[model samples]
Target: MTVVQIRPARSADADAIAALILPIQQQEFGIPITREAQPDLADVQGFYQQGSGNFWVAEAGGAVVGSIGLRDIGGRQAALRKMFVAPAWRGAHHGVAQGLLDTLLQWAAAQAVAEVYLGTTAQFLAAHRFYEKNGFAMVDRAALPPAFPVMAVDSRFYRLRLG
Candidate 1:
């Protein structure tokens, strides 16, 4: 298996990341509500200028097959967001997500962040297992701010301590 390279996202990567995420959003939410719901990226040029979160893309064979980002939540925590892997590449890309996550955690540690949090729906049971395998523990949705949109009413929140 070829090793996947992880790197900070460039302006050129915004569309690719948006394309990769479109289907997952539709599948999970049953609606095409990303560029509209989020709206910054459909314009492409402005999207790159806005710089969506602290973005990163995983490259293999010169193509981005997976992506993830950390959204600064203020204080000592950052929320993991927009994590996805192309369906065809999921098997070969297991560690790629973890690698991105490990890098994000290292960055959080450097910034003295005490915790990292993520939200996902109950439908993604596999994702829940993956988070647990990586040392995250499930927490109440109330633990997150009410402002954060819950993807599902029963969406689960997970947190991992940086220490």
Candidate 2:
């Protein structure tokens, strides 16, 4: 088994995370992402500054292979966001995603959050299965925020009750 390390994302990890996610996003969306859709080091760094979210990266053999983030949603809940694993690193190491989810769950628990939610595209069937395996259940589309357009078309919402 490959040894994987999970750590809070640093500003230096922004570019690497963006590179890891852009292709996946592009392929899933079937459209070229604009600069606005692509996350940069500055954006991840900013999230650290705001105190409203946490970002983490997974490393194996000293190389970043995956990342995930959690953003606080007012009232004891958090929204899981930006989860991606390099195509080269998928499969049996499913533990990597589990590790990320575990970390986020711990953080949310610390904040007294009772539940966590995530929005993902239908194109990512593997992710849907992963979320379900991790105790998330599909929720009504109307339960999500209005700004989340991805939910209107290809998106599905999953909720994990922490309590």
Candidate 3:
């Protein structure tokens, strides 16, 4: 298994991060979002910088293989976004996703965020299980925070409370 390093994303890592996520968003999950449509992939640092949030990237052999983001929605709450892992580095073996999440959560705790929320599509069954396993609780759409920035393709939502 390849060793992975999870760290805060830099401005230069935008393209590699976008390349890593587009395939999964298109072929795997069949999301309609395109690279041109999702401008955030081109500016990771700018997109996730709201309130007290930040973005993270997982790299293996200097290549970005996974990512996760925390978007602060004010009122001590934040929204989790762009959590993805490449197929070659998935499962417990690579630990890419977990590392990214652990890093984000560690930062979130330090930032004093009370809750972290996310919106995902119904087709992501594995993602749902993964989120649940990591302490995110499923909630109805109406329960989502007003500032959560709901995406057009999002059909499910989850929230996790931090200490």
Candidate 4:
């Protein structure tokens, strides 16, 4: 069995991260967003590796297979973003998604992040279930903290609190 290592993302992993996420977002999810639209992808270090926030990648066999990011939004809050796993690496057998989430949660707790917010489209039914199953509660948009970063494509929001 190939070992999957989850670690902090570096500038060198930028391309692999983009490669892993673009297809899942554009082709699989049919989201019409381009690379330019998401500038964060171009500078994961500058965007996510600051304050109490971070970005991580799941690497297996020397390739990036999954990724997740935490964006510190102040007030002990953070916005979870850019979570994606390769098609073959998904599900309980691989545990890529859950592993990424677990790492994020652990890091959040260490950072004293009181709340983690995420936004996704309703079309991602599996994602909604995954977040819900992981102690994230669905919340109305208006209920989100003002500092929360709401993406243009996001319609469904969820929040998870950590002590």
Candidate 5:
């Protein structure tokens, strides 16, 4: 089994992060998104690692296999974004996704985040199940906080309240 390390992402991880997410978004899911659409991946420090927000990467064999980011939107709320796990590292056997999420939640709690909201495409059925199983509840678009960043392809939303 490969030992996966979950750690805070640095500016240097931009390329690796982009490499891990774009294919999952465009090819596997058929979302048709471009690298230009995800400008945050280009500036992890300025976009995600500022204020009370942060980004994390799961590394195995010195390569990023999974990523998750929290964007502090003020009012103690945050938008969870860019969560993706490479196909080879997914599932309970690898636990890349779970580890990334655990790290994000721990960091959010430490930063006093009151809620974490996420927007995903309706086509990502497995993702919807994973989020639901992890204490996130499905929410109508109208229920999303005004500050929550909704992506152009996002059609389903979920919210997880934290202390």
Candidate 6:
């Protein structure tokens, strides 16, 4: 089995991260999300690392196949953002998605992030199941923290409280 390394994202990883996400967002999900709308892809360190946030990438064979990030929302809360894994690297055998999320949750716990929330489009049925299986509970947008950055395409919401 090939190994996947989960590590903090570098500025140089911007293009790879975007490359990994764009196909899934545009082609797979048919979402209109563009790189222009996600400036964080262009400036991972600058944007995600500001204040109390961080971005991570899953690298395999020198290629970035997955990405996940966290934005501290203050009041011991955070917003999970930009989690995407290459289709070829998904599923339990590869563990690419799980690795990225595990890394993020581990780091969030150490940072004292008591709550983590995320928004997703209704089209992501499998993603909804994945989040639920991993302990995130579905919630209404009104239940989200005031600081949660709601995206234009986000119609479904979920939250996880870390211990």
Best by TM-score: 4
Full-model lDDT for every candidate: 0.71, 0.75, 0.90, 0.95, 0.93, 0.91
For each candidate, give its TM-score against the true structure: 0.81, 0.85, 0.96, 0.98, 0.98, 0.96
Higher-TM-score candidate of 3 and 4? 4
Score candidate 3 by TM-score against the native.
0.96
Separate clash counts for every candidate: 0, 0, 0, 0, 0, 0
List of clashing residue pairs for candidate 1: none
User: Which residue ranges in model 4 land beyond 4 Å of their true spot?
Assistant: none
Winner by lDDT: 4
Candidate 6 at residue 162, lDDT? 97
Model 5: how far is 136 from its true place, Å?
A: 0.3
Q: State the local distance difference test value for candidate 2.
A: 0.75
lDDT of each residue in 30-66, candidate 4, tens digit only: 9998888999999998999999999999999999999
Question: Tens digits of per-residue lDDT for model 5 on 1-163?
Answer: 7799999998889999999999998889898888888789889889989888999999999999999999999999999999999999989888889999999999999999999999999899999999999999999999999988889999999999997
TM-score of 5: 0.98
TM-score rank order = 4, 5, 6, 3, 2, 1
Clash count, predicted structure 4: 0
- Positional deviation of residue 45's Cα in model 1 after best superposition, in angstroms: 12
- Regions of model 3 farther than 4 Å from truth: none
- For 59-150, candidate 1 gives per-residue lDDT tens digits of 88888878876766656667776777777667523577778777777766777777778888767777888889889999998787543445
TM-score, model 1 to reference = 0.81
